[model samples]
Target: MKHYTSLLFISSLLFCWMFISCKSTQRLTDWSLVWEENFNQKKGFNEQVWSKIPRGGADWDNYMTDFDSCYAMRKGKLVLRGIVNHTQLNDTAPYLTGGVYSKGKKVFSDGRIEIRVKLDPAKGAWPAIWMLAENADWPVGGEIDIMERLNHDSIVYQTVHSYYTYTLGLREYPKSGSKGMIDPDCYNVFAVEMYPDSLSFYINNIHTFTYPRIQTIEKGQYPFNQPFYLLIDMQLGGSWVGTVDPKELPVEMKVDWVRFYQQKSIK
Candidate 1:
């Protein structure tokens, strides 16, 4: 009987050790820093780390523009500003400036992504910090929006798009009253925690939404497991942002930083 009791005790101790170790390993908050860009001193986008969206109207979804350098650095911040100019395509009015991107450079997968950004409060500014799969297709591999703003309100959106479906999750804080605004500059830290089984969105340190992994990714399609490049742009007057107010021209989206973290491996 003593021999059996000793064996049981040893088994229980082993199980307890394993449980504690797993609990520690599963803690997402204890992530290790894998990559980050503070954007503190650089005057322009790093060519080695980022590629510019070439000057052209074909790349833009539907917005019209006569591309002339739309991005600049001012007072230690990366600023995307819109410019309006006349174009031969439309003689009735002047062409408005816009931006769209992600061609080459840094890309990755299966990690936490964060961006610190302040957006323009103008009526037609649509600014976004997002990611697209390395695969040469649209929504086939996947798309993850770390932060997106529509000038209609102070609210911001974080979303994930797959070939199967698109999900837009929202979190808003008013500038005053019971729902006080999270920040004064209309800016906040936005982050997305991407895991094998789920995705979580965080705004200004507050957890807002969690999406469970979809099983059977449909037609054997699971593209999110691959690396994706980041895209940051300030589009003017799109379906989401609507028509621009001429008085609101030359609006800017300020980016403080972009960071990435990865959970440590259990093994």
Candidate 2:
């Protein structure tokens, strides 16, 4: 009887230890909220966190930049309106759309980024919340797309494009793309938790995908260690989105909030 009781006590102690161990691991990541934006301002978009300029680097897009009426803040929500206008951007695009990037304003190396948003349910309304390297050039600098829904897609794509993944095609084995089902009319939390070696994507707090570091691959393939800035936009009539419906003009991409957190355990 004593042997049996000792065994039971030992087992109970072991189980308790394991439980505490798991909880400690979760507690290790003491995340500190670094920056956040709720878009609750009554008048205009915050210029300190975002820039109104539409970068000319998207050579594949067939649209121009417009700052006058393309974006607005209504009822504490930031709206990125995509419209068909006669606005000419170097005679290349006649449609006026809105995009905001945090190039020189704010950037982070390793942290957690979350954006709560809802896309307008209109065809050719391509909305995305993503990040790109601030220092390096296109593809080579690394692009981490937390959520990109195009052409009224019911699914959101989470992808990473880097020189190692795209230019050299080193990411051919594990397949560096993932998607999650989402509703266009409702607000969903799209997030990316960037670690030292990997990027984990989440939608509405559910884990959707993970882009792990290729330790065996070349170092050039991993460009996520550097500081990356955020970009939120509603791109209209791009090559990927096809033609727009004039009747669906003035599609609004509403953003409720955005947050950034830097982990203290990442030393």
| Structural similarity to truth (TM-score) of each candidate | 0.72, 0.82
Query: How does candidate 1 score on lDDT?
Result: 0.64
Best by TM-score: 2
The lDDT per prediction is 0.64, 0.80
Clashing pairs in 1: none
Cα RMSD of predicted structure 2: 9.7
User: lDDT tens string, model 2, 138-252?
Assistant: 7888999998887768898999998778888876644577989886678888989898888888877667878887656465667788899998888776667677787878888
* Residue 91 of model 2, lDDT score: 48
Q: Candidate 2: where are CA atoms >4 Å away? A: 1-30, 55-62, 86-92, 217-219, 264-267
Candidate 2 lDDT at 211 equals 83
Task: Give residue 216's lDDT in candidate 1 (0 to 100).
Answer: 55
lDDT of 1 by residue, 53-80 (tens): 5444432334433344467666666777
